[model samples]
Target: MRDVQWIYSHEVVARPQSQQPTARIPAPTSAMQTCGPLLFAACRRRGRPSPADAVCRCLVIHLSARHDGTARRGGSVAATTKPSRLAASPTLPRVPIPTRTRSRMHLHQLKPGEAASLPRHLLEAHVVALVRRCCPGLLALRAAHARLIRLRLPRLTAAFALSKLLASSSSCGAAPSYARNLFDQIPEPTAFCYNSLIRALSSAAGAAPAADTVLVYRRMLRAGSPLPNTFTLAFALKACSIVPALGEGRQLHSQAFRRGLEPSPYVQTGLLNLYAKCEEVALARTVFDGMVGDKNYAAWSAMIGGYSRVGMVNEALGLFREMQAADVNPDEVTMVSVISACAKAGALDLGRWVHAFIDRKGITVDLELSTALIDMYAKCGLIERAKGVFDAMAERDTKAWSAMIVGLAIHGLVEDALKLFSRMLELKVRPNNVTFIGVLSACAHSGLVNEGRRYWSTMQELGIKPSMENYGCMVDLFCRSSLLDEAYSFVTGMAIPPNSVIWRTLLVASKNSNRFDIVQSASKKLLELEPCNPENYVLLSNLYASNSQWDRVSYMRKKMKENNVNVVAGCSSIEINGYLHKFVVSDDSHPEIKEIRLLLREIADRVVRAGHKPWTAAVLHDVGEEEKEVALCEHSERHGSWLPALTGNATTMSTVGVYSTARQIFR
Candidate 1:
């Protein structure tokens, strides 16, 4: 049969035959009219009449003839074709064509039993475009997917189309499981398909989705057809970071190295972030240094944050300086890390400078940055300044409120902390675990045992599970209120095992209350949990010494030697002129150490004259009385306090002011 081109319009117009005027077919019936253009276009594009064409042709003839058995326009049809079984069927449901997509019908001939061999690229492109255009929601996506299945296209074509569908479904709020099922339908899933699913699941909330992302990446690797690319490795590493699947992350790092993707900046950053978050700072730094060129903000931020997490404040600040010298602009994330380091070091002067720098440089002090500033100021003994930052924030989250509340609690403003917590609840802001920690700490500070218990019950009512920190706070509350029996009972009744911190808290309280029996028990538990901790050994040894149990004291010292546990020197930091100066017990390294010691002796004489006696019981060693007094005077906190007084920086005055005021009053 010869091929024919039909131009659809209000009237049916056919291409002219040799020596024949263009034939006009009468209009189709209402039922056929609705589907006429679609059926004719499909048939014409295939270049031959299929069973659908027979139905289309028969419908046209049956509807075009008048009721009197006459052709309305006196038009003669070329052939009278028998209708297929579907010819008399009801009107088919209309498939809405996207307004943006135009029809591209071609008149290509195919042999009998041969399917259309669409250009692979063109077919894939068209199907992908169609899927994206129609899939605005899950329902629309599913409809498009069903239409694709009905077309029975080749496997690769269908896979390409389904890949787009998978991407859309994952993004349009479809569950991760739905995307996984959709991906399984693809016969040979492409790397793009796997990458899309992995990225979506990794970014989704909850552990299960993140785990699914790793599983999908693993399946992609095991399939061995489409190798995991840089994107796949990066996303999988991100999931590992969230899950903290350090073991899996290590395997992916090795895989990246094997695939020569270690050089990729994306892969390097992913590896850096994974290791940084997992607290493998050494590995994170290794990855960071291995990068070929200048590090970006993300790399710098991750490395700095790793240092802050491990309490390596000096390293974090030093790297921040390096980042600045490198001419790299620090983003909010980098500033937050730097601020946190300053908080840990009590570098108040530096923290203030960073805050000013943020304003001077026009960097956005978002909620997170503001919250960090609050924490830094509060920890630096500037609670008022912390409150200023908290109040200045345009919007506050649970973290911001918690930071302020905790700051107040730490500063011994127990009533204020409780008041702010009440305001938070009045505003309907949900309090998280950290908030309760602050609240409980405030209660502990003021010996509000009943209030502490009430808040603990309230936390449970709000579905906020108490973390280890919360449990420790509750134990401290009981101990501080002199509820020794209750504190012990609480520790015994804890749902989770009591850690060394809890045991240490109980031991300190027992020692303070002179309950030697409880002290012995707590000391035993503390030693069992943390035998290498010099503080625990030193604490027990001091108790033994105070009670005149010289043999037990000797035994404690001997056990310390056997365990190779050396006591950690007490250290204190004071910030002056934007510089952090640290001093350790008996430290004489400062250039002005002789002058500081001379001034300290003069102040000690005045304090002693005013009946201020040193508490020599803190010295655990069997030393002379004079030697114990000397050790107390040489403490790091005393040294740190005198330096700020010597510098005349009133902002840093703390213990020094007490000595100065007492001497003046006595004189």
Candidate 2:
């Protein structure tokens, strides 16, 4: 469709000016209406008083004469064969007569100030025509911009024209420096000029950052003229959202409210989004609840998204239900937030229902929505379903591919994840940092040390810096493969200081590998990094006890008591239907706690009968073996792991897998 439109526009440009009707353009038909403005602009471009202006002046006079029947009676007027003004300027193509119908507007109707405005508008239209010939490129725009400046149009005219140039340049993906320089030349910019510049900067790459846009808005305010309108407020809020400036955004919200602009859905939605991105969910909800009359999907979606972004899944879900109750049909944005909440809460059933709703309602599955769906399915432990969603996507972006890869990697489909990564590279889909994290994590988990190194090198070669996650993956890969010394060296060799997680990973792996040298060093570093984290002391004590260093174990326990440190008890949750039920270690808060405990005991007995002895070393307390086994049974993860089987819902398998991983970590 775009190609066809481009061809039509090009055909208008391709027609030579000489080939236009040589006969005097008759009667003010729709096709001839814009000739006056186009000719006037062209004449000005060829110098202030060129012969082209003389010719156009004569043509308009002749047309008026003919219209009033002052010319030869019943006779047609003909253009003279004399050398034409356009003949000297073959480069200026005849302005295509716009085919679209327009309301009657003439140069005569415009006031003195607006007389300059018409020529500038027509000039921009001509420039737009030229830009089409060299579009998706900046050269024509650069030339047009230069010509406009040289013309020295009136101040207001120039600002308007420069604004158009800036917009065109940005739309063509040109370097914004030219536009920025052009904007700086405007002596006193109007509201249109500021709005255009702000909008362009908001969307441009590597241009002024969002913070700069807010500064520009502040400058506009300081100008004290050209008070901001709806457009200005919308763009300003967008800039605030991008920079995530909660204070400035809230201030703007108040200003807009005082100005009575909150009634405008555009301002309302923009303000809601600003609060959402800033993670001020409560304020966003206040804005949402304050909205009067019929609410749009965007306003509701923004509020729900605010909740989802801050990991308040229940609130997001509740809002989704309220939105439905209000008969505000959910759009793609709403669904994305709701699905994300499901992913966070591990609500596979609700996520699936939303997915089906999308299909049933025939909602457009854009890249973002599709990516969210993949993430939801993968995180829900329906990895194959996630892969299916991924494969079926007609247009997959980096996020889509990364979600699938990460999902597969976490679910222990290591080889499958790597294969997809290879395929992604083969298809020339440039992998991002997230993609590398997934691939490297897959390698680390599968003990593909050499493979992990190769990917790390590939990432560097691709100019992708290894982030903390990447470093963690490498350390984990070494540690998992029992290369404690190498892991320690890698940690030391890191360009940035290792976080406690890195040191902790090494400490746990060292104890497993019986590397006392690394265990002591890593534990000391962990304690220093997180002085009050009870896990560090507990881990050190466990290592000492494992090696029968009873005195050192006793000393570590004493230090933990002196510091008043307490371990954060493990907890797990499983989502049934749409509600999440969480269990804490030795939890007795649930009304069904007795039944759950009995069920866990029964499962533990069945496990023993199946010749699967519980790994009890994770119980750090010095207790009898039977007591340690009892402690393992009372663990929250052990109880949560039975939800899928007892509830007869296989969809909660992801919860079980999570429990297994946690159990393995302790083991």
lDDT of each: 0.77, 0.73
Cand. 1 Cα-lDDT: 0.77
* lDDT tens readout by residue for model 1, 1-667: 2223221211132334573445555655565555555555555445545543554554554564543212211111111112223232233222232222211211112122222365565566556665766656778778777766655667677777778888887567777777878888888788888888887687676766556766787788788879989988998888888877788889888989899999988999999999998999999989988998888999999999999888677788889889989999999999999999888777777788889999998999999999999999887778889999998999999999999999999889999999999999999999999999999999999999999999999999999988999999999999998899999999999999999999989998998899878887898899999999998888788778888888999999899999999987766666667666767666788776677788888988899999999788888779999998887778666676777667777564442211111111000
| Superposition error at 177 for model 1 (Å) | 4.1
Q: How many backbone clashes does every candidate have? A: 0, 0
lDDT of 2: 0.73
* TM accuracy, model 2: 0.73
lDDT of 1 at 310: 84
Candidate 1 off by > 4 Å: 1-99, 103-154, 165-179, 204-222, 586-589, 606-612, 645-667
Across 97-199, the per-residue lDDT of candidate 2 in tens digits comes to 3311110122112233443545555544543454454455677777766665555557656666666776676567665466577678777777887887777
Which pairs of residues collide in model 2? none
Given candidate 2, what's the lDDT at residue 462?
96
Off by over 4 Å in 2: 1-140, 166-180, 204-210, 227-233, 247-267, 527-568, 601-616, 622-630, 643-667
Quote the lDDT for 283 in model 1. 92
- Worst lDDT run of 10 residues, candidate 1, spans 658-667
